[model samples]
Target: MSPTTRVLNASTKALYRLCLLLPLLANHEASAEPLVIELHIPDAPPLTFVNDPRGHGIVGDVAVAAMTRAGYTVKIHVLPWARAQKHVSEEHDHLITPLSRIPTREDRFTWIASIMPMERAFFSLERRVSSFAQAKETYRKIGVGLGSAQEDILRSEGFSDEQIYPLAIGDNPAQMLLMGRIDAWFNGVPESRYIWPKVSKRKLLMSSVGSNADLYLACSKQCSPEMVEHLRDAVEALRADGTVKRVHDLYLPQ
Candidate 1:
């Protein structure tokens, strides 16, 4: 070939190679920019909490592992349940987990994955009450955490607003029950069980009141669809590989 023709062909090849590399370089730069994810967790022990001196908990660990695997830089903030839910509802790209999937909240957020199954129950001081019907008829007051699914369930079960005693986050309802401040306590099985031993020696009369609810990791409605899909895939993979179960087991009472 002529020298001029050879030079032109070489230039064309180089230009094509550069064109191919440009998009890849751009993608690399985008990926290098960390995906900043915020998780709003409550102080629910053995499920999600900041320990006295450390920060790892069951749901927190699972979430961090899954998101890290999915290439996100995660930042978890421990806050009151009400505040957490508010942040997820109002803030863009915020996440909350170990949240019970209830009818009222179904449309508020994009549910990413089911993390655990939870049962809501009514508990009275040992031998104080037997059936839910009896408790309803006898007790004039019930203690439940404000802004919790348990509180909603109680309201649906015909408990009047006057009969409901709303406790703040981190307040021990079991203690309230023992103090006779409330006739019964309505809460999740695991959470109630975890707190009962610390507050009372009497065995609680437990009566299941709600159907099994699945806890989920959910994101704000304003979260990008791409981010939601990424998180969903990561959590699904963790469940499939037993990482979720493993993390739960790690925090179970020994």
Candidate 2:
């Protein structure tokens, strides 16, 4: 080829390299800005907590597994429900795990496919709250995860405004009840048992309060729809292969 033509081609190739490398450098700069996810991990009966790798919490384990499948790295940050809720609403690209897609939040964000149906209940000092009817009279002076869907249900059920109390994410609310802070703390069936051993030495009053909600993987209002679709596809594959239930059973309160 002629020298002029060769020089022009070489310059074009160099320009292409500069363009590609610029994005790569920009991505490197963006590395410090992580995609933050928020969730409330309460300290209940059998459920537990640990850092990444050990993954002791049931929902945490399931979430890590799903994140692995989705090919996205996630940092598990635990905080009180109020704070988590605030950040999830205000931040960009933030996410909340195990949030029930209630009517109010239906239009809030694009949702990833559900991870599992959260089976919930009430656990007291000694008696089992097997049904909502049974709990109607007995669940006075109750402690529960604040801003939880359970709290929403109870509020709708005419549980006195003063009767429902919010517990810290990692604090033992049942123990608080046993200590007389409240009468009982609502529990998620398997998650409570999963976390029980960590908080209490003995099995307390465990009952299904007849409340259940389909939990979903929810992204913040600003998250891209494409990201949600990819996560949904990843979750579908996990369900197809039965990994989802296996993860749940392994960590479920039994």
Candidate 3:
């Protein structure tokens, strides 16, 4: 009925689920050799946020499953958006998933790619919105989710930081816009829901605001290219067998 009530409900369900997870993971030997992976997922939910030892949600589950299928043990680590990038860059023997692959990131790491599509999501008030170019010029400010790839893309596309605002993971960027804190918010698709209800209360609109991109599983520069190739094959098999789409359709928001 209320925003506080909704958040409270989600929080309680999370705590209840966590209490049941430790004994389950601790007691089991994984079906395949355990490979340590540094899954690079953000706090935005129904995507890669943790449900604990199970490491619940779509991207995380697909990675763990693919790793297991490839005969490697898996370990999931959650990082602040920035630290996750740093960890995958500097850490040895770790893998980061759901990372975007563009010319800029080319040759930076070994990659395991997916046919799956993802987007850099953004939103602004319906009544105030216009062509992206006009919005860029007209709005006094825009909110970018901190630690996101959107930063580089927007910068390369010529967005001035003077027009940019940054918000933490749980901050409601939509609310920020509705409250006149920013003009729009840019982030991943699943993240929009995080601030939707908040904006709805103010009768503001939220809509998709960026181009689509391919997502990948990236390993550190030190990881073997052959290993990366194997991971690529494993993911390809998952796609052929329909596991990738099944998971994609199942957990990810439409």
- Tens-digit lDDT track of model 1 for 31-64: 8987878888777776677663434567777787
All candidates' lDDT scores? Answer: 0.79, 0.68, 0.68
What's the TM for model 3? 0.74
Indicate the TM-score of model 1: 0.83
lDDT of candidate 3 over 1-254, digit per residue (tens):
99999999999999989889866776665533355655566665555666645355566677777788877777677778677877787766578866777666666666676645666655766544434566577666778766666666667667788877777654556667767778777666665654476447555454545667777777886786766777888888988899877877676446
- Extract clashing residue pairs from model 3: 33-73, 34-73, 35-72, 35-73, 35-74
TM-score of each: 0.83, 0.76, 0.74
Whole-structure CA lDDT of model 3: 0.68
Model 3: how far residue 241 lies from native, Å = 1.6
lDDT of each residue in 1-254, candidate 2, tens digit only: 99999999999999999998998989998875544444434333234364435464545556566666765677766676666766776767676766777666677765777777767788777667667767778766788777777677777767878878877644556568668778777756665655556666865777764676777777777877766777788778888998777766665523
Compute the lDDT of residue 89 as modeled in candidate 1.
Answer: 84
Model 1 residue pairs with clashes: none
Error of 1 at 212 (Å): 1.9
